[model samples]
Target: MTRTPEIAILGGGIGGLAAAAFLRRTGLPSTIYEQASELREIGAGLVMAPNVARLLRRLGVLEELAHHVVRLEIGWEFRRWQDGTVLSAENLAEACERLYGEHTYTARRSDLLAALRKSVPDDSVRLGKRCVAVIENGDRPALRFDDGEVAEADIVIGADGIHSVVRRVIADSIEATYSGLCAFRTLVPAEHAPEIARRNAHTLWLGPGHHLVHYPISAGKLINLVAIAPAGDYSVESWTARASIEEFLAEFDGWDPRLLDLIRAAETPGRWALLDRTPLRHWSRGPVTLLGDAAHPMFPFFGQGAAQAVEDAAVLAQCLAAQPDDPVNALQNYESLRIPRTTRLQEVSHGRSRINHLPDGPEQQARDKAFSDSDPLVDSAWIYEYDADTVPPFHIDTVAR
Candidate 1:
C-alpha cells in the first residue's frame, strides 16, 4: 500500500473517463487509452438518476456539469402513442429528491465527457491507441494496440464498450446480439421544437412494436429525440449511420401528429441498431477487468446503461482501495459485488420491451390501466436509491492467479 500501482484504462468514453476520475479521487492515478485521435463524444443526451447523482457529486462530475444540465422536476411521462395521452408519470424533482436525497438531471453526453475529462490529469489520457489484444508480459499484462504500440500496466480496466477486445479475453466469448430494433436519434434546437415539446420533462410514447422518448437537455436549449422502431433482421449497429427522414417518418406513420412535428424539425438524424450481450458469469481475470458496456451491455429500455457504468467505476475504485496489496482479489471482489446487480438490470431492461411494445388488446389495456393507476417513481424506487459509495465491501481471502 506504500506505492500506487500503474493503472491503465482502455476506451476514453464515459465509463473510461469516469473510472479515471473515480480512481483519482481515491489517490489512484490511471492512464486512459482512447481509440479516437481526440477525446470527444457523439451528440446525445444522458440521464442521471439519484443513484448516480450522489456518486457524480462526490466525484465532482456533477459540479463541473452543472452549467450544462437540465434538472428534471417531472421525471417520466409514459404516454399512449395513438392519442399522446398520459399513461403514467413520475414526479422526480421533488419526490425523488426528498426520498433519495438527489434529483435527476439530463445533460448532453459531450458535457458529461468534458466534465469527467477535466477531473482526470491532463497527461493521463493517451489518444490514437486502438487496443488489438491483451498480451502477456512476464508478470504484467500488456496491451497490443492496432498501431503496433505495446504498453504494460500493473492493472488494466477495460471500458472499451460492447465491441471490446478486452471482453474477448476475459468473458466466455459471448457475442453481442441485435434486439430487432433500431433507434433514430436527433437533437432539435429549442426554437425548432413545438410548445408541447418544450416542457422540462422526459416523455416516452409507447405503442405496438415501437416507442419514442424525448427529453430536454443542454440546459433546456435543446431536446434530444430517440425514436425506436422494429428493425426485424437489419443488423448494422454503427452509431454514425444516416437514415433518411422519410424512413424515420414512415416508421411512425400512425403516431401523434405533434410528435411527427418534432421528428420533422430535425435537419439530419443518425440511426444505429439496438444491441445487447448476455450477462457473463465472470467479469474479471486477475489484474485485468472489464467495466461498462464491456462488462454488461443492455437494451436502453431502463435508461441505466451509463448510470450502471458510473456505478461500476465507483465500486471498482473502492474495492481496489480497500485491497491495495492484492489487486487480483480486489477485482474478484468487485466482480462479485457487481455481477448480481448488473445481471438483474440487464434482465429488467430486456424484459421492458415486452411491456413497452404491446399490441392494443386486452393485455395492453390492462398494462396501460396499471400504469395510469400507479406512480412510476414508487414502482422503481429501488433503482434510484442505490449508493455505491456505501455498498458493503466484499470479504477478501484468496487472490486469483
Candidate 2:
C-alpha cells in the first residue's frame, strides 16, 4: 500500500459521505455514486447520541450541526399511557456530558445530512449514477450503473442501504422480515404542539400493545412524533408512504388527553411497516465491504440506526489507514472489528419492542417497576463511551470470503 487506494463508495447517504470525509483525513479520497438525482434525506428526525457527536466533533462538523439541533437537557422520559404517570427520566444535560464527554441532541434528518455533506468536496459525489451491479475481477472490483457507465476501483464500499445492489456480490440475498408492526411519523409545528411536547426532552408513552415517542427537532421549530402499533394486514415499507391524520389518531384511541392533543396537532403523517433482518456473519469479500444498514438492518427501538452508521464510517476509515499496504486485509479487519458490536445492538434493539409494547398485566407492571428503578444513561454507558478513533483492531483466525 505504497500508494493510496482508489476508493469508490456506492450510495451518498450519511454513511457514504462520512466514510469519504474520514478517509480524506488519512489522505485517501473516494468517489460516491448515488442513485438519487439530488442529495436529500427523508423528512424525519433522529437522535444524535454521544457516540455520534464525538465523531462529528473530530470530523469538524459539530458546530455546523449545532445550528440545526436541539440539545437535550432532559430525555429518555417514559410514562404510563392512561394518566401520563412518570415511569423514568434521565437528566441528560448534566450526566451526558460529564459521563460520555459529549451532549445528546436531536435534529432533522435533512439538516444532519447537510452538515455531513459540507465536510465532503462537492466534486467527489456523482449523483444519479445508480449502481445496478457489482462485478469482482481478481483484486479489483467494478460497479455498473444504470446509465451504461462502468467504473473500477482498488476498493468498493457498499453504503447503499437495506436493499443494497452491491450486497449481492458478497453474500446471498436475504429477504427482510416484517415485525408485524407499523410506525406513523409526523412533524408537528412547535406553535401548535402542547407545552410538554415543545420541551427539549425525549418522551415515550407506553401502553398496552402500542407505544409513542416525541421530541422537538429543527432547533425547536418542530416536534417529531413517532407512533408504533400492530400492523394488522398493512405491510408496505416505503418511507414516503402516506396515511391520514384520522387513521393515525384512531390507533391511539382512549389514551391520555394530552397525548391525543399532540396527535391532533400533526398533519398528514408517513406510515411504514417495520422490518428486521438477521445479521450477516460476514461483510467483506476481496476488496469490497458493506457499511451501515447495508450490513445489518435492525428495528429502530433503540434509536441507534444513524449513530451506528457514523460509528461504522469511523472504524472503517481507521482500519484502512492502519493497514495501508494491504487493502484486502484492511477490509477484513474492519468487518471483524465492527460485526460483534453491531450484532449485539441489533438483537438488543429488536428485544426493546416487546418491552415497550407489553399488554397491561403483571408483566407490564413488572416492566414499569424496573424502569422506575433504572437509570438509562448509566445503562447505556457502553454504547455512549465508545470512541472508534482510539479503538485497537483485533484479528480473527479466518474471515469468510
Candidate 3:
C-alpha cells in the first residue's frame, strides 16, 4: 500500500494549483482553499523561464501553455531607452535546453493558471473559503476557515501569497519590506503597440532610476509591458485590479516617446506594490510549512518568483514521498534544503538592481560594449539551467508544485 499525505494547501493561485497536481502525481491526497469564489485570472502577463517551463512540461502542460503564450527566441534583450540601441542579448532557446533541458516561455497569467487548473482534480479546490488561521497539533495540523468551517490534514502547506495568513501563523516571523519600486503592468494588442515591439523577445529599455520591459505574450498577439518607477514618486499602493492606461501614462511625462507610445497602447493596466520578504529561518513548524511567495518573496527582476515556487512543490513531494512514516523529518529536511538556496536568491535579487541600474557614462558605455561583444548569458548558466527535481545543494530543501 502506498503511503499518502493528507494535505491542505491555501491559495488557489499558481502555487496552490501546481502543488495539488504534483501531490496527486505522488499519490498524496490533498485539497486547496481559495478565498475567491472562482478561479479567475489575475495580472497581465508573466515570463515563465525555462526553470518554470520545465516543471510545467513535467506536469504535461507546457505544450498547452505554448499554444497560448509566445516562446521567446532570446531570453533577454537589453537596450538603451534614449535610442533603441541593443546592448546585449542572451539566447534562451539554446541556453534553456543546454541547462534545464526544456524551453522557456512567456504567457498571460490567466492562460498559465488555466493550464494548471486543468490538472487539478474536480472539486478538490474549495473556492471562497478564506483561511483564517492554521493551528498546529505537534504532528498534525488543523485549519480554520473564515466561514466557520474547519478542516484537518496531516500537513498544511501555505501556497498563499506575500500577505499569507498561514505563513504568519506558523512561521510568523519573516519580515517583508516594500521594494521602493511600484510596477505599472499592462498588456496591449500587438497591433496597438509600436511596430518595433511585435517580435518574440524580452525587450528592456533602461532610463534614469526607472526602466521598462516589453515582450510579446500570447504568441505575439498581446504585448506585455511593465514600467518600474521609483515608488518614492507614486503615493498609491500596487495594482488594485483596476487601473487605466491614462493613469500609467502620467508617470512617463518626460520619458522616451516610443515608451510613452507603448504605455498608451495598453488599454487598462493592473499594478502591484512590489513587496519582498527575507527568506525565513524556518519554513516548517511541526506538520505545517510555507511555499512560494508566502515563504520567500523575491524581486521580479530575475523573473524567478513562480519558477522557484514550482520547484518547491516538486521537491516537497519528493521528500515526503520518500519517508512516509516520518513526515516531520521530511518537512524539516525540506526546509533546511530550501532556505539557504532561496535565501541566496533573495539576497541576489536584493542586489539585482545594479545590473539593470547600469549607471550611464563611460562605465555604462563600457558595460554596454562588453555585453554587446560577449554573451552575458555565459555567466547566467547557474540561474537559467537549474532542474526542478534534481537535488542540488540549494534544492536539498526547496520543491515546486
Best by TM-score: 2
Clashing pairs in 2: 1-325
Q: Per-residue alpha-carbon lDDT of model 2 for 95-201, expressed as tens digits?
A: 99999999999999889889899999999999999888999998789999989999999999999988888788888888888799999999999999989899999
Mark the 10 consecutive residues where model 1 has the least summed lDDT: 392-401
lDDT of each: 0.87, 0.90, 0.78
Question: Per-candidate TM vs. native?
Answer: 0.97, 0.97, 0.91
Give the Å error, residue 230, model 3.
0.9
Residue 364 alpha-carbon offset, candidate 1, angstroms: 0.6
Residue 226 in candidate 1 has what lDDT? 90
Per-residue error for 88 in candidate 1, Å, reads 1.3
Model 3 Cα shift for residue 184 (angstroms):
0.7
After TM-score superposition, the amount by which residue 85's alpha carbon in candidate 3 deviates from its true location, in angstroms, is: 0.7
Superposed Cα deviation of residue 223, candidate 1 (Å): 0.5
Better of 2 and 3 by TM-score: 2
Point out the worst 10-residue segment of candidate 3 by lDDT. Answer: 392-401
Q: Write the per-residue lDDT of candidate 3 for residues 1-401, one digit (tens) a residue.
A: 24566889999988888888888777776898899989966777888877778778889878677679787788678878777777777777677667557666788888888999988887798999898888776567888988899899888899988778888766556555667777888888899888778877888887666778888888788998887767764445444655667778776667668788888778778767666665688888777888888888887777777778888888887777766666677788777767777888888877866666665788678767777788655566666676757763233443432
What does candidate 3 score on TM?
A: 0.91
